[model samples]
Target chain A: MTKIVVLVKQVPDTNAKIVVSGDRVDLSAVKKVMSPYDEFAVETALRHRDASGGEVIALTLGGAGADKVLKDAKAIGVDHIVRIDCEEELDSNSLQSALASTLQEMGAEIVYCGKSAADTGAGSTGPGVAERLGWASASNVTSVGFDGGLTVVAPSDGGNARMSVNTPAVITCDKGDIKVRKPNVKGIMQAKKAQVEVKTAAIQPSSVTIVAHSMPPAKPAGKSYEGGAAAAEVANLLRDEANVI
Target chain B: MTELIVIAEIAKGTIHTTTSELVTAANALGGSPIIIVPCTDASVADAAGTIAGASKVIAAKSDAFAHYDAAAWAEALDAVAPQGTILTSATPQSKDLAARLAARRNLSVVQDVVAISQNQLTSPVYSGKAMQTVAISGPAVVSVRANVFDAAPSTGSNEISVVDTTGNMATAVQEFMARASQRLDVAEANIIISGGRGMGSPDNFVHLEAIADTLGAAVGASRAAVDTWEAIPHSMQVGQTGKTVNPNLYIAVGISGAIQHLAGMRSSKYIVAINKDADAPIFQHADYGIVATWEEALPVLQSTLAGMMA
Candidate 1:
């Protein structure tokens, strides 16, 4: 059986009215959900588990609030979970180390994660983990399937770049693969009873940290270009005025 | 004076344009750069010799070192950094290498750093949302985001010193599948028109395509736009991890600029946003914004520009 670990994060649900105060994400009015891309990892894991007959484990470096997302994962068919809960504010570097240690402890055969965190967009964590663990890794993968070995389809310049790679590798899912299927009412209730294990981070002393946060400046009002000759005016505005063309 | 190590990334047997740019930045600091090359392929080594200001070019050639691998590179760089600042391009592979090497060696790693003075350096925070200058001390490994600095002209006849790293690496690059050959990357385009999920369907992009063709602009997409895979290709995605661009003009259609998406294009000189909803985050950074559906705005704007050009 192939042991698969999907690294998921608990993020504010869709349509959450975001209020950013400094580096903290204001989650007062928002409910937590599994990060969108990480859902792809879970989906891929379940698919692998169904075919390969191994356990699928959901993992995250989050706080107690992360349990909600784990429940969601359990409803979707993940068999095991590990929440490395810590208040030390681990960046991608620290998270990578902790994940490496965790995966080594579990002896998982494969690892998967979203290309980047929706909130941080660091995109470095997954690849960083693979590097620390001495495993092959690929990002922006559009498709995947296991045939004797794992074959990952990565979108390159325009077309897809497919490579049949070995196990003990890390792959990050991009958007637009298959959307996550909603858990049935029965599945949700069953998931509420699933077991969850929490762990603490093992590394400290990060090289990067969030210094502060600020909103981007407002865009200027757009002027509507009327019909006919105005098209030429718009063209000129785009070329000579905006110097974009 | 401290010694500096520069890994001059050469692709397809030639030095990337940013090679000279990095050397120019390194020259301002205290150290004389010791150039490191993973592949000692003759053509790339000869090209390395032409970089104007480098003190010495160190070349390591092998099939294992041909393609960019973060693990192998980090290990190799760790051995080379005992001397000076180990500077690398902020390209995808370079960032990974720098981060892994720094983490492995427990050395200080500064990434996407734009300008470096003697003690203070400027780096973009929140994906170019704002620039922060910080003071630093000690042995540092830094990766420079290529576009942030000017591509220094290659004019000097610097000396080339080749080094052997044939047996130094254990990890091998089996193969490489690069897709950047098809579409114009955001980094290189002067004009870009981006779409979001609000554009609705893939066919709707044709309207924006007409305008882009008229203006000779490239097509781009937000992560949401790319989510509709049928409409936009993944290559054109402009966002935090996707691609960072500084185009002359950027037109965002039906896009509710998420902070992640904005991080990719906020540096454009002029930004125009078209969205039915005025409250979109994109409008906050636009030079011009129109609260109109793309279906209505795109055709009208395209025809208007076409007629005016005629």
Candidate 2:
């Protein structure tokens, strides 16, 4: 059977207000959920496994709190789930290295992940993993199909490119017609009993270091206009003050 | 002297505007700036040589580079780039190439950097909620956001040096397709007119396209519009899950400001929001907000912009 792995990350809800204090971003009060885009990734992997007769394994690298996303993945029909236990933050290089090694050991032929983590928004892990494994990769993939061969549709500039890559490849999922299905009552019950396999990974040394953090300069207060007649005034401001006209 | 290398971006035999911006960025650091033009054609390299602020242009040409392949480009760049800082415009291709190069060199990539100094770089983290300043210990790869830096003036005495590849390519492009002519990418557009779900239907996007054409702007969309309508592709999506746009002017029509959407465009220099709901969240971030429906405001705004431009 084709072995597939989907990488998911737990991130603060998109609407949470991020508070940056000193050198760290304070997220103690935020509600954590599966990174929004990872939903599409999980759905994509399950579809691929169902079509090709494979076992879909969901993997996540985070602290113990990340088990919430793993159970959620199990409820969504992932065959197996594993979590790499780590508390300290791992940079992209270290994270990708750990994932590449783990996926290699699992003999995974196909790997799926979100294009970028919502928290860091680095958008590098998928491609970095591909490079580490010496495999072909595609990013921002909107669709995947199995028509005698695996075909992926990706958006490029203003057009779309339908691409086909060899196996042992990494594909980053983007939103498309695939609406992530909700877990049914039975699925939720099954997920509650699912056992999450925990594993330890050797953290790699980081090459880049963050020295400090600061808030972006706040935007000036907005000017509100009342009616359609305000169009002329807005245009005048665009031309005179904003100089964009 | 520290040798700062810039990977010049070439499209359809011409240097992209972002390459000159990278040159300007490279000039900010105290070093001898050089441009690396990796292309199949030599004329594109000659075009890159004319860019200002660069001391020399190294054109790495090979048949393997006839199309855009990140692995091949990264290999060519690794071969030509000296032991110093490497910079490129933060496009989809560049991001992939930078990541590959960083992994190959055991270095870290600072993606979508907005500000840079000799040793320190500042970039948006957590989808623009906060900015992080990182210190580079030695050689590193950096991808810069387009249109953030001024394009360098064309007055350089740079010479072009040609190098042939060894034909050791791991990946090949089966085909390359270009976008429609005159369509600007949201990331590089100076002005953008974006529609949201409040516009109600896919047919109403024509209103945004009309205004975009009038203002020479690109047409963008919030994630809601893209998810709701088949006509709006993911490429037009501007949000945390989509492309982050830093256009000079961003005009939102009928968009309720979601934090995810704001994360992509909150850095726009000026914002104008139009929504029928007076209490829409978009008005909070907009510089000038119109408390009217797009149907009531777009036509008048379009005619007024047409008159102004005409």
DockQ of each: 0.23, 0.53
Residue by residue across B1-310, what tens digits does model 2's lDDT show? 4578898876656678889999988887666578988778777787776678888998888876765555566666777777777888787778777877777676678888889877888888888988988887777788898768898887776889888874344433344456644578786688999999999998999999999999999999999999899888877899987788888899999899998899999988899999999999899899999999898899889989999999
- Give the per-residue lDDT of model 2 (tens digit) for A199-233: 88878887678888888777778999888778878
Q: Tell me the interface RMSD of every candidate, in Å.
A: 5.1, 2.6
TM-scores of all models?
0.78, 0.91
Best by TM-score: 2
List the candidate 2 regions with Cα displacement exceeding 4 Å: A222-224, B166-188, B197-203, B224-235, B276-279, B291-296
What is residue B253's positional error in candidate 1, in angstroms? 4.5
- The top-ranked prediction according to lDDT is 2
The regions of model 1 sitting more than 4 angstroms off are A12-31, A155-159, A217-245, B1-6, B9-13, B20-40, B45-56, B65-94, B106-143, B153-157, B166-190, B195-217, B221-248, B253-264, B273-284, B288-310
- Give candidate 2's iRMS in Å, 1 decimal: 2.6
Quote the chain B TM-score of every prediction. 0.76, 0.90
